[model samples]
Structures are given as structure tokens and as C-alpha cells.
Target: MSSGIALARLMFVVLGLVFIATASLRARPQSDVLIMRNGDRLTCEIKRLERGVLYASFDYVDGTVSINWAKVARVESRQLFIVQAEDGSVYEGALRTEEAPGKAPVRIEVLHPAQPARVFEQGRVVELHQTAESFWKRVSGNFDSGLIYTKGNDTTQYNLGVGLRLRRERWNGEVGFNSTLSKTAGVSASTRNESWVQAERLVGRKRWFYAGAARFLESAQQGINLQTTLGGGAGRYVKDSNSARFSVLAGLAYQKTQYEPASGSQNPPNAMAGLFAGNLQLFRFKKTALELSASALPVLTEAGRVRTYVNSSYSIQIVANLWFKISFYGNWDNRPPATFSGSDYGTSSNVSWTFH
Candidate 1:
């Protein structure tokens, strides 16, 4: 009977310890705080800031909420984050807003435990990414697919695109694949495929970067079996902001082309070219986004020969990470093998999904 009483007392002690531990965890403060221009305040966990939107999670809320960056008045967070500015400067640290009088421009302070603190204008900050323990959490990508059918000609067409990006403190990498196939009654099928890999490294505390890329293409319409290009160059951002970004690059490239037998070029020639390219991106909060890219390759080995490429896309968010996209692509070569077409252009509408 005495041993039973001792066991009961021990059990009571264990229960008390568990209760104290649980209560301590529940009382811990939230990780971040946000203030709105309308005088509202929120205590929540900030996920990231991208494309003029700040994503956050609240304990009382059901899911992640997106707030417009322009509407934010202040923010404070102790969690480490990767912040990027319009001038191509990047910082990693905790974030806080400076106290300012009415009508004054907002400023953000980045405080690092081991490094000196830095300050930047709030409007000049373009992106923020939370530093996660898992590497996969730092990756983001999108996949899009489209289909078209016509009963009159018994024609069908399908297109698919996939892209993946990995961003780090000073560099980023991207991979992309796109394909289109079409079939029609009493007509031969046609196909086009393109794949590319690109990498960029930040140069300094300004809007400068170095980029390298490799691309492969196959097009039945252009009578090309395969075309491969390798290039590297330096680029600068002309404009970088929440609503728009524009950049240009100039480089040198080498291209090797293999023509189909019917094109009558048994021995295909390789050429070295000068590359000029530009990219533009525009965003409208959560509503819409547009991207445009163009490149020109002037063959140095063969004078007067040129190749050009153009790609443009407009996307409207339907809900959350799902979007409706309309895209156009064009490829042109001023000179081609005998009997081969010199251009291929097409348009597609697709449904796309994005994830981070």
C-alpha cells in the first residue's frame, strides 16, 4: 500500500512538468508584425515578399494572405531573410521599419547578428525571401499546358512548358523546356521543341550581373534537325522596381546547326555570333503580369547572316497559384539551307500553376 501511494505522487509530478512545458511553448511570441497604412496592425508570420506582394500567415487566419506592398506602413521581424534592392544589392538579416513622420518616405533596416546593419528605402526594395533550413524550400517553378482541337479539319495541337529556378545570395540558375505538337487529317505532323539552362551572378552593389546560357532547339517547320547555342556576357538592369523590371545584355555566342536531308545541306556549317538581348517584366499586384524577351545574333563568321528570337507572355491570375497565360514565340534566320524555311512563329494559350 505504501509503494502504490509513492507511485501516484511520482505520476503527479510528471504531469506538472508536462503542463509547464506546454504552457511555455504556447506563450512564446509570434515571429513577425505588420502595420498597414490604414492604421491596422497584424501579428503573424511573414513568408516572403515577391512581385509587389507580401505573403503572411496568421494564427487566427485559415491560410496565407497576400498584402499589397504599397499598402504596408511598417514591418518588424526577427527571422532571417534575403532582401534584394532595385540597385542589385542583396542583404541577409532581420528586418525592421524606421520611425518616420507623416508624409516621409519609409525606410527599412536590415540587422544582422554578426554583420553591420544596412538601411534601404522601402520603395526601392524589390524582393524578400525567408531563409529556410530545407534547400527545396528555396526553389520555385511553374508548369503550363494547353490543348486545341478542331473538328472541321480533324486537327489537334498540344503545347507544354516547364520552368524551374533556384535563387541564392549572389547567384541564380534557371532551366526551361517548351514543346508544341500539331496533327491534321491528310497532313504530316509538325513539332517544335526548345530547352535552355541559364545562370547569373551578381557583380557588385549596383545593377550589374554576369550571365551564361546554353540553348537547344528543334523545329520541323524550319527544316532543322537541331540547333545548339552557347553564350556568355555581362548585363545591367536599367529599371528595377515592384511594378516593372528591364535589363539588357551583350555577349558572344557559338552556334551549330544540323539541317534535314531534304534541305540539301549535307555539310552544315558552324558560326560564331555576337549576341544582344533584352528582357522586360511588368506586374500588377495579384491581377496580371507580362514578360517580353528578344535576342539578336549577328554571325561574325558569315557576314550579313543573322538570327533572331522573340518571346512574349501575358498572364492573369485566376486563383492563388493558378493562372491563364497567352504566349507568343518566334524564331527567324535570315539565311538558311537550300529549300528550308527561314522563320517559325506561333501562339498558344495555356493554364499554368506555380509553386515555391
Candidate 2:
């Protein structure tokens, strides 16, 4: 046999093996529920192949669907689950554990396969999350938004603010800033301004969540008031929904209000201790969310008396990475300006940009 002919045969053999390898990695048809490496399961209507990833519409508790996608993790039979190995081999069975479960090796049971059962070597199987995390952050910023509203007196002011956030875990602490401004004209004079630095940490693994924060506010003529608050609550996933977080929280907040009159007069310090309760939610369509809360001020001061307030907001996603947050807020007190009531509402839309 000629040397050139032998080389050509070898090349054909190599090409055949490559074809088999590529065909083996093809994605299977869609399924009802997809369980991720992070132990989160999503129930969605698997749409169609857009680019290369599987697009899905997640079912929400409130009869809505939000678009999402499956990470590039290995998937298996409709009845059984399997994860693929870097060496072109598959570990079949229920996904025993995440790719890297801290100190233990991930295990899988074939049950009916040729090998019957196998425990995956952490070194051989690539952790799907490691790559998915980085890839998602690159593209996730394309969508985000919310709505807020506030009201005081017969004259109500409306303000709106919206922004995007980067979330790590399925639930974790996120930092984002938003500002809203609005004015109301009525029998009584009114102006509203609200902005805050939002930070929240997920403390519970299961739905019993805990979070705390310090909010700094500079409202219309209200000067600067800082409030320190801590709270905890529980939530549940209704059936296979992805957008509703039904929760209730009760917490203590201490607020200090300072004001300097435009007439060059200094007002005495005003401090108030109060309790707040409300429901937190992520609404349907992945565009709207709401929180309805009330605060009670029982203690009285010389410069201030007992008062009660209600704060509620609705956030709407207008476009990719931008949203309009509107708040309906109100305040009522016994102090006589004789029938002192105020209501304020406003909307703000924020858009985000990323620089590589």
C-alpha cells in the first residue's frame, strides 16, 4: 500500500469519529419541567430554537408567562435525568447532586444502562453553572423594570423611577439605586421626591426569608430622613409558577427627620419609631410587581404626634433594561393644620448600559 493512501485512510477514520461525537451531543425534545444544577426546577412551555439555546415561557401563579431559557447543562430522558461528561460520555440517572456539591463527588445511577450505575468524578464533568453564570450575566441586562406610587392630601403627586439589577443566586442580595420626582397642585401645596439605595440579602434557603436595610430619603421640603429597618418573612411557590412571591413582613424602623426652613430657621430634631407590615411580590408577565405596606406611629413627641401612613407601589417594565416605577403614598396626622391630609404619586423610567 502506498504511504499516501494509508494517510488518506487514517484521515477518513478520524472524520467518521468526529461526526459520531457531534451527533451524540444533539439536544433532545422539550419536556414539562426542567431541573437545573442549582436545584431549581422550571415548568415552562418550551418555545422554539432561536439561536442555540432552548427558549421557554415560565408559568406564573397569576396566569402569566415569562420568557426564560435553560442553561447548557446536559439533559436526558423524559422520565429520567442525565448529565454529560467532558469525555463525551454520559452519566445517566437522577441528578444526585450538583456538579460540585462542596466536598462530596456528584453521583448518578444508570439503573437500566449498560453500566447500571456510576459516580461522576468532579474532574471529568465540567460544572455547567461555572460557564452558564458568566454567559448569562453578559446577556441578562437586556431586560429589567418596576413601578412606584405615593399620595398625600386631596392633592396627590405622582413620581416614577426604574432601573436594572444583577442577581447572583436564584435569590441573593442586590444593589441598585433609583430616583423619582413629581408635583401636585390643589387646594393644598404638595411636592414629592423619593430615592433610595436598595440592598437585600436572602437569609433562608426555603421560603422563610429574612432581609434588612437602611434607606436614606430626601423628599420635597422634607430635608433628609434616614430610616434603619430589619425584617423577615416567608414565601411559597404556587404550583409551577415563576413570578409570584407571596410574603408578609413585620419589622421595626427608626427614622430621624431634619429640616432647615427656607427662612433660615432651624427646626428641632424629629425622631419616630414605628412598625410596618406588607406583602412583597413579583408580578405576572415579568413586567409588573407590587408591595402594599402600612406603618403605625404610636408614640407622641412635643414637635410631633402619633400618625399612620400607607405606602404602596406598582412597577411596570416598559422596555429592555428600562422600567417605570410609580408609587401611591399618603400621610395623615392629628396635628392641626386642621384636616391635614396629603397624597403623592410619581413615575420614573431608568435605562441601563454595560461597557466591555
**Candidate maximizing TM-score:** 1
Query: Mind giving the per-residue lDDT tens digits that candidate 2 earns over 118-209?
Result: 55543343212111224222111121233334444333333333223333333333222333434354443333433233344434323344
Worst 10 residues of 1 by lDDT: 19-28
The C-alpha TM-scores of every prediction are 0.88, 0.44
Error of 1 at 242 (Å): 1.1
lDDT value, residue 95 of candidate 2: 33
* Candidate 1, position 321, lDDT: 70
Candidate 1, after superposition: displacement of residue 109 in Å?
1.1
Writing each residue's lDDT as its tens digit, candidate 1 over 143-196 gives 789999999999999988877677787888887778788999999999887878
TM-score of 1: 0.88
lDDT of 1: 0.84
